[model samples]
Target: MIQGDTYYFAVHLSKYYPFSKRVDRNYYKVEISNKSEPSYKFYTIKELSENNKYIEAVSIPPKKEGYFLEREEKHRNEY
Candidate 1:
């Protein structure tokens, strides 16, 4: 994102494992750096509340390059 912009991630887990399968949906505690970024992101979060909801968890400043893909998707849907 930009210098001071904030980004949030929503983690969703589908039904996996036989008896233990469950849906753990929650707002990610922090922004997720893409797979290629230097920091290790929470790809597989172990626990999340089922009814977690967030409004536009990620924010980008005027010149943020990190959420390029996300920006493109948002633009396409807007029009």
Candidate 2:
């Protein structure tokens, strides 16, 4: 198994937010980045939104080197 950096994301869903209707709960379209300059590589999940909700967290290994694999694209649709 490849070792990857960990990431965390949170989505708020309430009846009132900034005095507006609550935004529908959604899954994150994970986009991993090395965050470290000189080694920026990242990769995005193809289709795994349904699996994650509210707060999505995951660990993804580097592509080839220590560089982070970034996500190029992502699409969210109801199934």
Instruction: Give the alpha-carbon lDDT of every model.
Output: 0.35, 0.31
Model 1, span 1-79: residue lDDT tens:
3234433353343423221223345322332332322133322222221213222222324355658768787798676
Write one digit per residue (lDDT tens) for candidate 2, span 4-77. Answer: 66542323333232212233554222233323221222223323333352123334333453333222222223
The number of clashing residue pairs in model 2 is: 9
Can you list the residue pairs that collide in candidate 2? 41-68, 41-69, 41-70, 42-68, 42-69, 42-70, 43-69, 43-70, 44-71
Worst 10 residues of 2 by lDDT: 36-45
Residue 69 local lDDT, model 1: 66
Backbone clashes in model 1, listed as residue pairs: none
Give the Å shift of residue 41 in candidate 2: 26
Model 2 segments more than 4 A misplaced: 1-4, 15-48, 51-79
Model 1 scores what on Cα lDDT?
Answer: 0.35
Clashes of 1: 0
lDDT of 2: 0.31
